[model samples]
Target: MNDIAPQVARRVLLLDGAMGTMIQSHHLDEEAYRWQGITAEGSSEILNLTRPEVIAQIHRSYLEAGADIIETNTFCANRINLLEYGLEDHVDIINRRACRIAREEARDRAYVAGVMGPTNHALSLASKLEDPAFRRFDFNDFHASYLEQALLLIEGGVDLFLIETVFDTLVAKSAIIAALDAMERLSVHVPIMVSVTFSDASRRTLSGQSLASFIETMAPFPLFSLGLNCSTGPEEMIDLIQEMSETSPF
Candidate 1:
């Protein structure tokens, strides 16, 4: 574990709240959101460039508000997500710049956890109805895209990586694999935290895998922590969290 990860177990760390809510408070128009025609609406990652001052201000606000960890505003900086805005070519720089901005603001005051969102697209789905088991992007394709983003994030000086808001197991597996590969290739190890979204009271993912099963599937990877996020209120998640605490290794 990184210095920060150990403390997570021993103490309560306050993470900053939603990034979009903070950004929306700025009232930035389309020009600011687009940042020179490189990003589309609903994609906040580009704020790191066009409105970096805004991003920095938000980070400072969270830190002032007593957040222990500030995540980079690069949730969609990966190749898979960036492709939605025609940003496939700028993947490396986008992620690096976002992490750099957060690192500067954090400045040893807090940990900068790189935020990697689940890429909702599927690779193993076919275009034609004739074959259902076809793939537009295979496992290697998913691995390479995630590896590229992870490398840049590490180079940009994040204290750790947070694979968050994950709904699909396949994509989560790909991200975990890519992160491991990135650490090996870069020769730098950082603690990784995995968070999955719950479908409902069942404590299963949208794909219908139980929390215990999710843990089982992800057991091969060394994760600093694994828990739930999104699609549920506290009343629904309490039992699930308790279940994970009793079942999970980390």
Candidate 2:
């Protein structure tokens, strides 16, 4: 992974677009995502171990297209989310290998961003709008899951961490805390980039926080960057990006 701070200081950095989108373009079937008699068809993360060349090719394509940062193929590789595919036990291998694939493909041409996505569940009360009090996992549970994944990403040699597709601020908070803790324990320091996803065109997270509120909540974290991703396209995001620039210190 290259030094990202200097690059950020110089000019605008082009982070690669959707990993899921690029993977989908390949049209991999169920067999492609399977390994050791375990078939996790929709789990793209499985390809990091089963079909690394597929992931490496995607990274290469983005780099060739002039992307500055190559995000890993570990979006849903966390233990909690992988449980859905009965892959709870392969979390470490999945995350570490994903990073390795991205890093090898990136070489010194681009940075490898360890992508940490929000899990299938959320800790925010409003996640269950009808039952605002319901909770599938608490902050501690989320923190632990992120911590385990973060540690492996670090060990796998990512240049930085990208907590992306965040629909819940609480989930983002947990991920940030877990990343910090993982760095401390591993004696490493890496920049953290966060990209929040609006639930809709409302410019608010699914947890029901406005962009302003989200900025205020995440203000204390030492984030490398805080901005928007997912939910909408450029036309809809223009105003939101302008608004974020005005309110966010990052």
Candidate 3:
């Protein structure tokens, strides 16, 4: 769990691809996405509970394909996003089960990366600082939701955390804070990887922060690795990554 970047860099460390995208390839409909009492849009995280064998199969595919790190299917398992599906009560169930499945699949051969993605309620904008007129989930809100997921993932046996697809630095901060707190409570420390998404060709986050600003904003955290994902193809990312490599301390 410690110095994971060095460990990963030691060999051909392969990370599993998109959980949502792979799930969609199954062609599962709303019925496969339903909760006991809630009507729904589509939520990929629910598959861990509703169709666990499928999730295990996904993890097995990556591991069998020689993956070094397998991310749990808990991308939208946080409380804020569960509210959108009216399954806020099932956050613990979703995340815990997802981690357990990944852990069981990975066994001793690979690492299980506890996945945390941005919520529908952006703590940056929803709890607007410059504009108090807008408010919902603030920094505290993000902290609680993230801490809940982190604790469960750790409990379910994960080696590290992957706070991926973060569009706002504050949102990532909240997850980092929660991770620190969760580790303190559990009396165990694990590595954390932070990845962000860009809006377009601007090389800036959707929150309007430049790549440098984003790096500066996240500089204080004890991250295992900080990089980009979900936007800007490999051609553009290579250049951006070179700049970040020269600039980033974590």
lDDT of 1: 0.83
lDDT of 3 by residue, 113-212 (tens): 9998998767556455687668687789889999999999888888899999989888899999999899999999889999988878888888788889
TM-scores for all candidates? 0.91, 0.96, 0.93
Tens-digit lDDT track of model 1 for 1-250: 2378577779999887779888988888888867555647777887777888999999999999999999988888888778888878888778878987888889878899988887757643353569777666777888888889888888888888899987778888888888888999989888899998887766777767888888888888899888777758778888888988998988
How far out, in Å, is residue 206 in model 2? 0.9
lDDT of each: 0.83, 0.89, 0.85
Candidate 2 ranges with C-alpha deviation above 4 Å: 125-132
Supply candidate 1's per-residue lDDT for 250. Answer: 84
Which pairs clash (backbone N, Cα, C closer than 3 Å) in model 1?
none
Better of 2 and 3 by lDDT: 2
Question: What TM-score would you give candidate 2 relative to the actual structure?
Answer: 0.96
Q: What is the lDDT of residue 148 in candidate 3?
A: 93
